[model samples]
Target: MANIFALITGLIFGFGLALSGMTHPEKVLGFLDVAGQWDTSLLFVLCGAVGVTVVSFRFITKLKAPVFAPIFRLPESNAIDKPLLIGSALFGTGWGISGYCPGPAVALLASPNWELWVFLPAMLLGYVLHWYLFKPQAQKSAAAAPENTKAEPPTCG
Candidate 1:
């Protein structure tokens, strides 16, 4: 049941991305090209998303449990750490260059493009490399941390 809900949610999100021209690299690039012929259409999309999130998140966080889960799991940390900064910089640089963030990139996979053929595999390779480089360090840090300081593992439920 939870899986079905997740699938439905993902389909709706993908549909929204497609409808909003988010799946088009050209459209995204146009939006990013500030000095050139700028496209402000995607700005409305971003504003709409942010507005909705700002309004909905307050109510959502107040709930004792999520609709499909026993607990309302949320991020425990709000720290602006080195890893967070580095990851943000990398993500922004990639998005600025390719004009396709992960969500829209995945959505575009339904209607495969020449760019996606390159981007998807590269994205997957990046994931593998990040895991390989960071996994051991993460494991060691987790092992060294005091039990009381350790955060509870996030669950899909």
Candidate 2:
């Protein structure tokens, strides 16, 4: 039931992205080009997303648990750390260069653009590289930490 809900939600999100022209790299690039012939259409999309999140998050967080889960499983940490900073930098740089962030990139896979062929493989490679380089260190750190001092792993839900 949870998996079905997730699939339905993902399909809706992808459809929304496609409808908003977010799956188009050129449209995204145009929005990013502040100095050149700038496009304001995506700004409305951003604003709409922010507006919905701002309104919904307040109500959503008030719930005892998610609709499909027993527990909320929210992020415990609010601290801005080195890994967060580095990851943000990398994400921003990639988005600025390619004009396709992960959500939109995945959404575009349905249509199979030429850029998607390159971007998706590169994105997958990045995931593999990050896991290979950092997963062991994370495990070691967690193992070395005292039981009471260790934090729970972050979750999306």
Candidate 3:
């Protein structure tokens, strides 16, 4: 049942990405380009997304549990640490250079362009490498860490 909802949502999201011109590399790149040929069209898309999320999340938080899930599985961490900073830098750098984040990249794959071929493989490789290198150590550290070290609950504004 969850998988069905997931597929439906994914299809809707992909269709939205396509309709919004997010699947086009040039459109995404143009949005990122600060000095030349900067396209403000995607700004509307961003604003619409933020607007919907801001309105919807207000109602979403009022629900006792998610419709599709028993519990809300959210990230526990609120700390702005070195790993977070580094990961953000890496992600931003990649987005600026390639002009396609993972979501758009996957949506763009319907056309199967050469750029998507390169970017998708590299992206998957990065994920695999991160898991291979860090997952074990992360698990070990979590296991060794004191049980009393609870992360602070996030404060809503």
Candidate 4:
């Protein structure tokens, strides 16, 4: 049931991206392009996302735990480090070049484009490398997860 809900959620998210012009590389690029016709519409989209997240987190914090999972998968780390900086830079560079973030990349895959083919393989390779190379060290040095994290109490109306 949870798996089915996840799939349905993903479908809705993908459809929303596609419908909002976010799945198009050109639209994203235009928003990123500062000089030659900068578009501001994506700003609204981003603001909407951030606003929703902030609002949702408020409600989520009131809950003892998640509905579907043992615990809500919230980030435990509060400190920013070198990897965070480097990863953000890499992600920004790639997004600037390809105009495709992970969400839009997956959403665009449904459109029958070769870009998805190439990007998906590259992304999988990155994941594989991260697992093989960094996963062990990360696991070893990992500190306690966030204090607020816990198993979900049953669903409530």
Query: Which ranking of candidates, highest TM-score first?
Result: 1, 2, 3, 4
Candidate 3 off by > 4 Å = 141-157
Better of 3 and 4 by TM-score: 3
Evaluated at residue 127, the lDDT of candidate 2 is 83
Error of 3 at 120 (Å): 0.6
Candidate 3, poorest ten consecutive residues by summed lDDT: 148-157
lDDT of 3 by residue, 108-128 (tens): 778887888899999999988
Q: What TM-score, to 2 decimals, does candidate 2 have? A: 0.87
Candidate order by lDDT, decreasing, is 2, 1, 3, 4
Which runs in model 4 stand beyond 4 Å of their true positions? 139-157
Task: Encode model 2's per-residue lDDT on 120-149: one tens digit a residue.
Answer: 999989988987898888778778988843
lDDT of 1: 0.85
lDDT of 4 by residue, 1-157 (tens): 7899999988888887887788888889999999879988888888877889799989998898877867665565565899779878988998899888888877776785888899878977876887689866655444343444234221321
Clashing pairs in 1: none
TM-score of each: 0.88, 0.87, 0.86, 0.83
